[model samples]
Target: MGTTSDQTAQHEGSKAAMGGLIVCPVDLDRPGLRVLDSGTGDGYWLQDLLGTYPRLVDGTLVGTDVTAAKFPKHGAPQPISLQIQSITQPWPSEWKHSFDLVHQRLVLGACGSFPHATAVRNLAELVKPGGWIQLIEPDQTCGIQDGPAMRDFIKLVTWVFERMGGHARYAYDVKRWLLDAGVVDVEERSVPNYLGARVPDADLARRTARWTADAMMPLLKYTEGHDGPIPIPREDLQTLVPRLHEELLERGGFYPLRVIYGRVPLAKE
Candidate 1:
């Protein structure tokens, strides 16, 4: 449901919300640094990392997704490898423990069919000893404000996620998942995400609103066509997007997020 421009806007918004491209304090200039981005939609995260640190041009950067449909039509940015991969399945044997950093964001929807903890464990296996594993996820359970329509939207989305077998509010438990995976020095950073007038920047607010609306459209349509206990009825679902946007613009909203990271323990340190 997200266009390229919409994806770009959301990517920039996440960067602004998190305050930087790389958040784990890992050295980007290190020679031969190896990095992996799971569920790399359009390879945006990998592209931004290389663009931010030109010295990493020689470093090995790879982005993987379950499919290549969203990858750049021409090719991934120079020196970045895009592959077809599913985080729930076994990765290439050669890739085991090969990356200095493993990163993923907003992919809980993709992990809906399986336990997210298992996916996290799979991602952790790719990190080299002493390397970092970082995950950024949207928090749907708290900080939301204004708009009964928006509240219904959240409820419908949460129902969809739960029906698909993933918890919509799984971000709160990610630190324990990392700890169980044997990752050390775990850190969780919370960031305030404002939509509509809640954000000081008007342009960003509008773009974020559009992104939200676009994302909700497909889900709304799905619920309308499918048989489920959707919070919004089919007739109301038809007008929900416009109402949600109006509420966001008039009253503003907050959707907090989490940036969690930790280092895999070094071998026999």
Candidate 2:
């Protein structure tokens, strides 16, 4: 999942299916536009945006991650910068209420390490008044109609995330959190994503399934509580992955992806 090729493909695939990067519909040509992508893995999303909206090269684009090691080596156009920072922690004081757009995708793992409310508030704090904050995350609980193996896999995923203080239901609760943070004009949409080649976009579905299978390995191997050296055991994955992959290839097997966006209320004049 850390590979540049893999990240790039994921970014492109998601963009193709979910529409453009930011959902708030801001003019890309707007001057002094500041954008922040928290947990910006591989910086692919920001890079794509900069490439597509060349005018944004003059605006400030920042990508933050826990480490800069996996950041794309090729320098982006001017005004693009990368910082090593944890999204779960208190952000720089200067950054508070500074960004025109704050985006975070698939950050459940990192955000789960801390209080969900705190994390959501930290992300909201970065948006300027009337600016937008967007979040995209998968519902890890289960697919639309999972088979035995797929069900088991979902259970394992939930167990692991819960053990690590994360949640599979974070997507569902994000809207409420945004509302509490004084965000307005909140809107959310969910896309049911098929894991196998049974969908119209067969290749995309299959590739996504395979990518998900590949990503689940390390997660399954995670050790938890004093139960055993191996939490679920590696052998289980060896048997489960293939079966789950096959299950996904069939009809009625899909996961839900939630996209939530809201605007920070403008300050009273």
Candidate 3:
């Protein structure tokens, strides 16, 4: 009972999605770049990056999410363009090997089961010779551990996502896929989510509770397609929120977030 593509796009992995955006600010410095992207919900990364480096006016960009989004706000010598597309489908044949960079970030189940190899192959095929491709995913191990809220939160979400037949653990070993795809000069970086990081970050914790509720709703109602036992109740979602809130504040508070990414030139020099 997860959200439709529209609603689910909002919370790309907490830190995993954000980490994908952490691509080298250096990529923006190169001239005349063309970037093909995957499932960019808000397009904040491109909006902020083009603004960060006005010289990138010579660059071109296109983004694809399952659904459309308002064009991002940016200031640059050239306008940034976005394209919305389905993750499960084949490439739009005309655009093969066309982009200077291909990036898929925190798409989890959307990238396909072998997200590591399959997604990497997709990105590699889109990049022009000498161009590059990058993949960013999280290994939520850092964010998980034995604890009250932490343990409960993990169990609930994992159970819900896994049951849905979707990826709840794209974080682990995403780069291995990149390497297998023959990407060269590959590199990786890991960063923490800083849960409830500061006052501003507290909202992250709240939102997660909301998702847990949404994830569970589908599981409970869909079993046996109208004949199975009610595994969970609507009230259960409400009950967890307050409990999750309190757990985030306890000492040694949860920090369940980490991102790893890899990048490589599309062609050998």
Candidate 4:
């Protein structure tokens, strides 16, 4: 249960890891561009997008999540329409084929409860013909440059993911899912998301460490309650924060995130 600010910081690290706010080749300068960020925890991505491409102010920018409690309700530099929408469920009929871009990230938990392919199809249907859909998900099966502690942590994560009914490496099949949903020209890119030590930017690394801890602590609680097989001793779960600090501060590791995007086919003339 990461707080809104913590989630926002995690997304900032994600953006930095990906190298920018956008990875697709879509032109933001296009007039009347309508963008949708599904599972927008706090609308930070929408805010960043508007800041990066000021012209979008004239267009529609919408952010949707299952809840709106975290949405920026005041002092937003740009206008953003926030909605309570679940990507795993049906969307409003009026939204079909309406957006120039549909973006979703870190919805692996939702995927646990719903068919991921169905979710992909739902997102694909929202895109205008020739528009794009982008998905960013962590490759939880393993980490990049993982030290002993990180490797053990990944095992715990994989265990939790399986318990939730989702594949630990679900990201690897996203391209196929998009293709099955009739999207074309699909492309996938990956980058290492650093959480601690070794990051050239000290402040960002520290922020990422806090974000990671916040995001995982709740899961660790769940693990602590369960009486099943686990990667580490059940009692040791209480000391996760300090262990994470040492792992991140001493030998730093990174998780890999995959960015996948594809375009909807235009209607035949």
Give each model's whole-structure lDDT.
0.82, 0.75, 0.53, 0.81
Candidate number with the higher lDDT (1 or 4): 1
**lDDT per residue as tens, model 2, 145-255:** 677766767777776777778776778898998889888899998866555564567666666666666666676556423365443455675677677666666743556
Using TM-score as the yardstick, the better of models 3 and 4 is 4
Clashing pairs in 1: none
- Tens-place lDDT per residue, model 3, 1-269, is 12233233224334343554545433667787777667665555455556666755677767677765444444222456666676666778877767776766656555434334565577667767666666655444434443465555555555555556555675555556666766666666655444332214444544544443344344344343534333344455445555554554442234343333344453444
Clashing pairs in 4: none
Instruction: Please report how far candidate 4 places residue 136 from its true position, in Å.
Output: 0.4
TM-score of each: 0.93, 0.86, 0.69, 0.92
- Per-residue lDDT tens digits of candidate 4, residues 1-269? 23335456677778888889889988898889999999887778888899899889989998899987876666344567888998777999999999999999888556675888888899999999989999999887556567766776777778887888887788999999999999999999887777777567787677666666656686787786787788777766667766776778776778889899999999982
Query: For this target, which candidate reaches the highest lDDT against the unseen true structure?
Result: 1
lDDT of 1 by residue, 91-165 (tens): 999988889999998886668788888888888889999899899998885453557877877887788888788
Report the Cα lDDT for residue 238, model 1. 82
- Cα lDDT for residue 198, candidate 1: 80
Candidates arranged by lDDT, highest first: 1, 4, 2, 3
Q: Cα RMSD to native, each candidate?
A: 2.0, 2.9, 5.8, 2.3
**Candidate 1, backbone clash total:** 0
Would you list the clashing residue pairs of candidate 3?
Answer: 1-218, 138-171, 139-171, 143-256
Model 1 off-target regions past 4 Å?
A: 1-4, 142-144
Which 10 successive residues of model 3 have the least lDDT summed?
A: 1-10
Decoy 4 TM-score against native: 0.92
Report the number of the highest-TM-score candidate.
1
